[model samples]
Target chain A: MPGTRGRRADARRNATAILDAAVECLSRDPDASVADIAQAAGVGRVTLYGHFASREELLDAVFARAMREADAALDSLDLEGDPRQAMVLLIRSSWRIVDRSRALLVAAERGLPHGRIRELHQRPLHRIERLIERGREQGEFRTDMPVAWLSAAFYGVLHTTADEITAGRLDEADAPGALTGILLAAFTPPGQPVPTAD
Target chain B: MPGTRGRRADARRNATAILDAAVECLSRDPDASVADIAQAAGVGRVTLYGHFASREELLDAVFARAMREADAALDSLDLEGDPRQAMVLLIRSSWRIVDRSRALLVAAERGLPHGRIRELHQRPLHRIERLIERGREQGEFRTDMPVAWLSAAFYGVLHTTADEITAGRLDEADAPGALTGILLAAFTPPGQPVPTAD
Candidate 1:
């Protein structure tokens, strides 16, 4: 039992290495094989199997890693700017993450069950909700709407922008600016009341 | 050559029938097959091939049909209500199109070359642009921002909402009302000048 525990620990380490290597290789080449990932991780076939029983498991691990990385990015982001600016930053950051992990995203899209990735999205939604409340209090955003609706719109903008960029209809350089403009136009408060020149 | 040309005309009819059947069938069942489509359309194997030559070709035709249907919806849509109401209608109508042709959409997402379907989107963009101009001219919408940005945001909300409904995250019935509130909140003018409560 003592020796078995030690082997399990070693096996876990090898699995992590293989998963990291798979994430890297898959990001570069979606069709990268398990052998290539094992080679990249400097692990033997037996070691790789000791960790992941099959290629599908290895790919799933890589996808989970990418999701965790994206989650960490969201968690560590500083959203201290004006509410509108903060929203823009969040969307842009999300696009960057999606772009960086496009291959894995495509794999997740095709292979994983629908809505699995979305379960990891609640934290980002809560953060954005706070920013929306602050913007409303600051008189910069509309106060009459529900936070859930705003959250949906925020997500909509992010997902649609990512799709546009992925489809090559939207230029990557212009995505952030364009999306910012859209969000601002939607959320910005009304200006000075101009009396009608009758 | 004359005989061949006559045969080709009949082939074109059969191909169109096959594509229509495929779109209808696929809209209901994404896994629908070539044989199913051919049977539904009452087309013989030889006739189906004389037009499509492959399942991918039939899929391409179906995607093209869906895009064309979307454009037709835009063209025929009455933009007569309050600008906000008109915009809401536009979103709802677009969502309905996607819902009705979800099978075709799934095929388009998987099989059609990316960006091809979006090209059919420009007509709706222009319509929304004109509507935004009307709202601004009526002093209901913001004048400082570009209409293009507003147009894109409108599409973004619709696309995102449709996707959520497809993925079963957002309730299908809630999409219209929720999106309308978000769009209106985002676009509505800020505070009217009044004495400060504080």
Candidate 2:
């Protein structure tokens, strides 16, 4: 029993190391091969294959890992607060996770099949949809647009803002606050005066 | 002299046909070949080569044509009105132009050199920059963020909104109005209450 437990721990450790290494490698080069990933992970090709049958499988694992991290980040936002404040928290938290997962997301978009990619986004999308619905119900967000379109726009702006940060057009330090302000302003009920200086 | 004039007319017609076909072919498939474009244009390979010596030259012509069309579309917008109302007209007119040139833009991103692509965008970017500056001068926009970043964000949101429209996530009819409202709201001077419900 003791031997079995020790072996299980070893396997788990190895898998974690490989996943981390794969994320790093693939983020740097989406076209990286299994041999490259194995070298980065300090594991042999055979050992890498033992854990993931193919490069596709390894990429899937990396994408899954990134999704889990993103979801975990979202979960930590204490989403039950005031809808406006909760949204601010959500934006700040999600942006950090996006910054960390940038390379993984790029790699997945390039290498993963569309269906798999959509599946990976499904959970996050649902969580965001629910949040938007809550905001609408609470009268924090305007009811003019459907929750679906607003959710889509939310993602769209986040991505564009990230691109700006990456290009040095926008300061990373200021992005979260700026994004929160822009999003809230855009969603304010039509005819409501613009937000006053806080 | 008559013979020369007749030949010039024929040459001009052929050039127009070739350029139009190139736009259509490249938009449909960025990887399309010169031969494919020539066939679509109903011009012999020899004649196509006679007008443009290389594929690169042909692509440059297609990009130039698309830019001109976009510029013309912008020209139609009455930008002399209230800055905020002017922005709405600009968004609506520019979006229609973007919708038309969507294919060309995608192809150019894939096929054109980065420097050349940036050059193509320079004019339109300047136009947008000027519009933003005018808004600030009129005190319709916030003075806190740099005009440059706001311009970048403007393009980013426009592109994302375009994507949503293409995917049927946003209705074409609703896009211009939504985009204008969103942009105005975001740029409204800080500390102002949200716009009254119109």
Candidate 3:
């Protein structure tokens, strides 16, 4: 157990260092070479390969790290407030990730393994679903529509809002309130109380 | 006016021919060369230049044709039966355009003189706004949300659904219904009657 413990700790350290280097390289240039990443990580080519078999695996790891950070943010997000306000906060937080990891997203768009990421990406979405479900049960969200559809619509707005922010068409500060108002209007059940703006 | 009439007829024919060739070429390959387009249209490069001036202008014509087609589809679309069903039909028609002219969309995404095309793109969106406004006024759509965000959300879903279709993750036939359900849920006014699925 002692030897196994030491090996696990060492592996974690190397993985962290490699991911950090990958993030830096991708931020500067999405098409950064593996050799450059290894150099930055102060690890040899073989060591880097040992952790990630291919460039795609390395990129996937980098993407997963960003997603993990996003999930961590979700962990601390307060969803107990009025569902509409809560959703707005969640979306705004998600936008911060998209903004900071712009290069990673660009790379993913060019051609990253999507199947692997879809499940990881669905984590935040599942949380949104729960909130929508809560709103529905509380008579705040319309009961006629399925949660699946609401989730898709939520994702749709998030995508467009992110695009607007990236393209400098809309100020980031205004996106949360704007998107929240729209979602609230779209999702609020009839006769339910509307949440006051934050 | 006899000589003037002949000249006008010839100009109209040439413009129509240019637009037809542009649609064919852009749909097949958005990045197709101008020389190729001229050859396909049976016109000299100089004549093509006389008509369109630049690649951006030609793309603008291509997008205009697509938008016109979309607008025409809206006229024929039967959104009268049920709001949700009608919305689904509209989304389906839009998806067909995306499928048929994916190459052109890729070109648009790459960079089409955003100024005029962007304005033209908003034309259909403005029309959608009117539809949504009508729905809200009629108590079919939620009244509290800005139509602009809902419109953007619709466009975003269209883009993503198209992307999924292009990538083969989602079948084209299933997309409309799936997307329609989500949009209807998002847009239905609180306390308003929800349509039962057929």
What is the CAPRI rating of model 1's predicted complex? incorrect
lDDT of 1 by residue, A69-174 (tens): 7878987888787776676677778768876777776555554443455555666677778888888888777554456556767766766566565655566676
On residues A1-198, what C-alpha lDDT tens digit does candidate 2 reach at each position? 559889889878888889989988887876788889999989899988989998889999888888887887687668897787777777777778877666666566456653465567667777777887888888777776656666666766776666556556678777676777777787777666655423
* Range of the 10 consecutive residues with the lowest summed lDDT in candidate 3 chain B: B189-198
Model 1 regions lying over 4 Å from their true place: A1-10, A29-60, A76-114, A117-123, A126-149, A166-181, A184-198, B1-6, B43-50, B77-89, B110-116, B119-153, B184-198
Query: Pairing residues by index, what is the TM-score of model 1?
Result: 0.69
Off by over 4 Å in 2: A1-19, A26-38, A42-61, A103-120, A196-198, B1-19, B26-38, B42-65, B103-120, B193-198
Write candidate 3's Cα lDDT for B60-100 as tens digits: 77788887887787677766755555666776776676667
The deviation in Å at residue B2 for candidate 1 is 12
By lDDT, highest first, what's the ranking?
2, 3, 1
**C-alpha lDDT (0 to 100) for residue B168 of candidate 3:** 62
Which candidate do you rate higher for lDDT, 1 or 3?
3
The worst-scoring run of ten residues by lDDT in candidate 3 chain A lies at: A189-198
* Clashes by residue pair, model 3: A149-B182, A189-B190, A190-B190, A190-B191
